[model samples]
Target: MADVAESERRILVAVDEGEESMHALSWCLKNVVSQNSKDTLILLYAKPPRAVYTALDGTGRREDPSGYLFSSDILAAMEKYGAEVAVCVIEKAKKMCKDLQQDVKVEVRVENGDPRDVICQMAEQLGADVLVMGSHGYGLIKRAFLGSVSNHCAQNVKCPVLIVKKPKTNAFNK
Candidate 1:
């Protein structure tokens, strides 16, 4: 068991290229994480596996005639796009922290896998005190069909999970 005094408080926030996730990050920064050296904020992004596409040759053959089996360019482009999204999210999180005047340590991690699996695994591996994420606020049928990453992470992770749901209000409500 790790000593209480020596263990730093690790708060892991799962982020993506979505407004909901960004809202969760902002909420975590404002509420959960403290501005102290003993607290660390980890922003995690999971890139889903790319789909494999096949190109036909001039003779209508399924495989390429140039001896190249697959399109490396397509794969590279997908990876590049994922990297850019990850960088953008991380930078935004950093800026949010700066705006909040939080001096806590911030770390960014990007991995290729399912978001549900990646978030839970990272929370456990980092010994996080709490895992924060955004709720898409899907309805029963939609959530049943599409499934929920936050629900899966909440169920699977060892630490407590915080799901930030976006507030629904009309202009007149405020």
Candidate 2:
């Protein structure tokens, strides 16, 4: 019975908006697929709250309180990229599973708040058996800054954690 159950385990993958995450998600879908065990792919995106602001207009006129968040272009860009990225992850995971002949459920989620905190909370709430993710890969110049997601999960998560540390590609590649 233990052996029977072992083969039917489910995997929960947390994907960030980066190449490494895409790579990790791709790898899992291709190699870990199984007819017995179901894989659950969860894509995580940042949804930080908008910043409020007050401004004055011309002719000594005061404008009503409002917020731009950051900038019109940035907000638009973020919205576009966030939607595109999440869809890409879902499509990639689905394509991989289809090709691999596995039965898996992929869940793509976009949420607000700190990435680290949100990921940890999501992992627990979903009762993920294992968390598959990539180590901090993009930006932050490994020598200077590090992403908090990997570190926080390693320290706080009770389930097993898989960290993909593929070598750095180009200076900007993750």
Candidate 3:
């Protein structure tokens, strides 16, 4: 028991609006976190960077593929929406942590940047013992185009990374 108290681990879990991430968090809480020991669960959310749009014709007007101009107000609204999503994700994660284990310590961190970079940076900065996150399970083509955040963090971060894949539910069961 004394050694258990001394061996507290800081587990960092990356969360987002996706159900996959929430599932990872829930799994970590139930399996990795120690109830009798002093363990810290850090929940991290990376709000995407503000969108940067360039005009197709380079006339200083941001235009879509269809040539529809995007106004500054639209950009601002998008940013606001991202912030709101980050807040919601963090709150939901916190609630889940509390519901599962009332004794464990839980910390929340919200950062702005690409999740791949932000999660790695936070894990290093916080000196996490282990990093846990969810895999989106993208196929080869989609992963090639969008890049896998979990895969990038696993390769770059110094700490151990756990990528939890949510089991696919049958449509008929639902």
Candidate 4:
């Protein structure tokens, strides 16, 4: 019994506003989570770093390349929106966990930083047994430009990273 109790795994699932992450969460609940065992599910949402308008870049540019300077009011609204998004995503994930497996324990962590760094740090700090996240499935050019978060975490994290790619639904099905 002690060995069985100690064998329980801590699954860290990265979720966001995207449907891909939600699909990954659903898949983890169905496939990775066990019904008989008391596994802990950690839902992680990485809020992107807040915009900084105080300092100019090394090139002495106050405005971003978009040529739009964000006012204090706009920045505040953006922060508020980010918080709202985190809450909504966490609530949806929790509901899914409860609906699918009521016995399992679910935890949530919302950190501020780049998703790549935040996810990796949380996996190590929390001692996650496995890290599961969705893959945006960006093509070669887009991936090169955007940089894949899953790939970065898979390479950097100590624990095994499961990058779940949400399958594309046929247009006819819709």
Candidate 5:
């Protein structure tokens, strides 16, 4: 039992619907995570919170027939979209592992919250040995305005965080 525990490694990778995130996952599969039965790869996707709709007027009076800001149909569509994104990310990660010929166990987790908070909390809860993510490679001013998820994860996660910066190639640039 102790030997099995010793051999097992939990690697958490943050994935999103972006090329940079996929590149990071591919890099982790090929370089960081080992192809072993005891090793597990966890792909985490943080779905943004559902948009809040308000029907209040200037005097805070209800202005819409429905009390809720968003219609039920809109909420349902948003939920479906989030689910689809999660499914796609999981499938892509699995395919990357298969393409690399790595037989590591894979798990998918989809949570709704701030990406930075969710990622940090998940990494700690999972006792991940390493947390892998990709940098958007935003410039200083852009990052300052938009904020950087990779930067936040690195500072807050308990485990070592690997931020993979995608290299620029002719094919990628075009």
Candidate 6:
């Protein structure tokens, strides 16, 4: 939350461990730089699929990792960069704007569930005015293989959705 006063404008952003997320967050800061309204920025992470969760133990048994639940991996990753990454968004905002404490609120929400469903539900629950997300910059093949969560979020969420796709990298040159 910045010092901008868009009382009706709340942003919910989804991150998938990519720099694109940082870009989106930066965009939000730019938009709400002087905002003085009460606003929230939710940093949400959908739970990985059963297969991804199972790969840890290599047991082939598919178990739900529990959406919105904090796990060791999540905490460990947050611990990196001296826990600065976890606090980066709000900390940066606080540093930039002296009114954050008096006017705006920022929260980090880590949820576990189908990303598509979780994003929409969380936005609805929070009464979000806009949903922000990284595009993952997938090509036809990668989108086809993994399914596009941003695309799904755009289609399903009632509010306007901003899908921020990073410039294509060599990772998807099929």
Q: Judged by TM-score, which candidate is best?
A: 4
- Report the lDDT of model 5 for residue 18: 90
Tens-digit per-residue lDDT, 9-119, candidate 4: 999999999989999999998998877677899999999998666433244554534444556787789999999999999999999999998998989999999999999
Which candidate, 1 or 5, would have the higher TM-score against the true structure?
5
Task: For each candidate, give its TM-score against the true structure.
Answer: 0.82, 0.65, 0.86, 0.87, 0.84, 0.62
Candidate number that wins on lDDT, 1 or 2: 1
Best by lDDT: 4
In TM-score terms, candidate 5 sits at: 0.84
Which rank order by TM-score, best down to worst?
Answer: 4, 3, 5, 1, 2, 6
lDDT tens per residue, model 5, 77-161: 9889888978887788778877884577888888889899999999999899899999999999999999999999898887899
Clash-forming residue pairs, model 1: none
**Predicted candidate 5: what Cα RMSD to the true structure?**
4.1
RMSD of each: 4.8, 5.8, 3.1, 3.4, 4.1, 8.4
Expressed as tens digits, the lDDT of each residue in 85-171 for candidate 1 is 778878887888778845778888888888988898889888889999999999999999999999999889989999999887799
lDDT of each: 0.82, 0.64, 0.89, 0.90, 0.84, 0.66
Candidate 4's TM-score reads: 0.87
- Rank candidates by lDDT, best first: 4, 3, 5, 1, 6, 2
Error (Å) of candidate 3 at residue 107 is 0.9
lDDT of 2 at 35: 49
lDDT of 3 by residue, 1-174 (tens): 667666989999999999999999999988888777688999999998876775432454445345446677877899889888888899999999889988889899999998889999999999999999999899999999999999999999999999999998898979
Could you tell me the lDDT of residue 115 within candidate 5?
A: 92
Question: Model 2 compared with the native: what TM-score?
Answer: 0.65
Clashing pairs in 5: none
Q: Taking the candidates one at a time, how many backbone clashes does each contain?
A: 0, 0, 0, 0, 0, 12
Off by more than 4 A, model 6? 1-6, 32-34, 49-104, 168-174
